[model samples]
Target: MSESEKAARLSVFKTYKLFVGGKFPRSESGRVYEVTDSKGRWLANAPQSSRKDARDAVVAARKAFAGWSGATAYNRGQILYRVAEMLEGRRDQFVREVGDAEGLSKSKAGAVVDAAIDRWVWYAGWTDKIAQIVGGANPVAGPYFNLSSPEPTGVVAILAPQESSFLGLVSVVAPVIATGNTAVVVTSEASPLPALSLGEVLATSDLPGGVVNLLSGRTAEIATPLAAHQDVNAIDLAGAEEVLAKELEIAAADNLKRVRRPQPVDWAADPGTERLTSFLETKTVWHPAGGSGSSGAAY
Candidate 1:
């Protein structure tokens, strides 16, 4: 064989970076750790996000929260649905990632990917209707109109589940953004490649930058600062172990941050509105009953 035919082409490796402020950046500490498949075979090197990186993610999420929370629910739904569309288009790639990360067969991994995409679509459908389900008019025996509405809780920190990887990660993340809250997500410690890949999908979708920042590193190290961040409004400890969850919960109490403790969850099962509501706050308004000429007083 000739030299051209005999020489094999070198495979170009992908540089996995943290997704912060809608840009791909190496960790602030410039560290990376090998991400491996279920059988301990190296898949790639994922950015080892630092405390500074976590803080940066919070800054991004906080900066984006106003615009994201202010957007109309219908518009938010449209963006989330667009994410589902993008995920659907990249189904095969996720299937391979999930299969490698979770030690599943191609068909099983494909099923998980399908579930994740569908989960995104499901949350998309909830965006406009959650208010009606969770908020409404209250009967008051006074010359006043009382009503309550659900509002986003601002920046949320999420620990992506270790076992389920892609499916679990989507399950935790889609809901926070669906309800208008921005998120800083720490990917699975052992299996972060799929989560990093997910950042690429989110970047391409209509979802705004900083709406969902992705970080990969030691879960405990990344989560500690987030739990205590004064600017962070809430945290989900789905991926934290018992001891770590307890520690983080205590730290969250410093700022009275909303905490969702770690619980055994079936990632593939029907996820109800709990995750959606966990990071939402209710704002109740009491307006005096009035015509145009009446006093514009609110009690």
Candidate 2:
């Protein structure tokens, strides 16, 4: 074969890995699936991850929690913003990867990639401000003063949307982290490439280990344990399979885990600030009043 012919036919095997505790490794199952080109030609095999893999990611996120949630808001904001920079540097890769995974034309894929990166930057700006936005002072019905504020909901487990994998993943992760919640995200089962690539961007972007644990596997098998996991204070079902999403909602009821049901989003549609709402938790405080000189509700 001519050199050009040899190069043209050279098939690259895609090795998919799970990201946990800031490191990437093969799925414990040691299995992979054959991806295909638009014409249905073989591309490469990705990891056939398992429920065990999902559990492992959760453990990592749980372990990383105390430190990550404890991080200074400014520091967390800086790291979250750095993910956008990393995404920008990897734009070409995403353009190609998303095109292949979502079957989009190159230009369309690039546009989506650009939007996803921008979304991360948008959320990074929220890290320091989200708390102030969702929370405020309230008039007391009694002799005491009261204030309500937002707090992190502890470790969050997410099932990211599948269609617009990159941006959907960003939507889920950004809001969760904006309120100081660390997360364990399940890679889209049929399309896990962009999600894993995102993990690399996040890791290199100075995200603390376990701040975002990514597992590639069957979404249902993995997410069930998480919704029921007592330690997981919240579960973002924004990407759950139909039966699975319903099941998790029921399972979440067991522990009263704050469940966010999946909503079909038109990625091309403008997402208002409403996406920033769920991650917030209300903590209302009351203080005793003595003098009339006391503050006005004390924010």
Per-residue lDDT for 1-299 in model 1, tens only? 67887677667899998999999999999999998899999999999999999999999999999999999999999999999998999899899999999999999999999999999999999999999999999999977789999999999999999898999999999999999999999999999988999999999997899999999999999999999999999999999999999999999999999999999999989999999999999999998774535565444
Judged by lDDT, which candidate is best? 1
Q: Write the per-residue lDDT of candidate 2 for residues 16-59, one digit (tens) a residue.
A: 67788899878788877766645666656666667677777778
The TM-score between candidate 1 and the true structure equals: 0.95
For model 1, name the residue pairs that clash: none
TM-score of each: 0.95, 0.89
User: For candidate 2, which ten residues in a row score worst on lDDT?
Assistant: 290-299
Candidate 2 ranges beyond 4 A from true positions: 1-14, 37-39, 141-143, 292-299
| lDDT computed for candidate 1 | 0.94
Model 1 residue 148 lDDT score: 98
Stretches of candidate 1 off by over 4 Å are: 1-7, 290-299
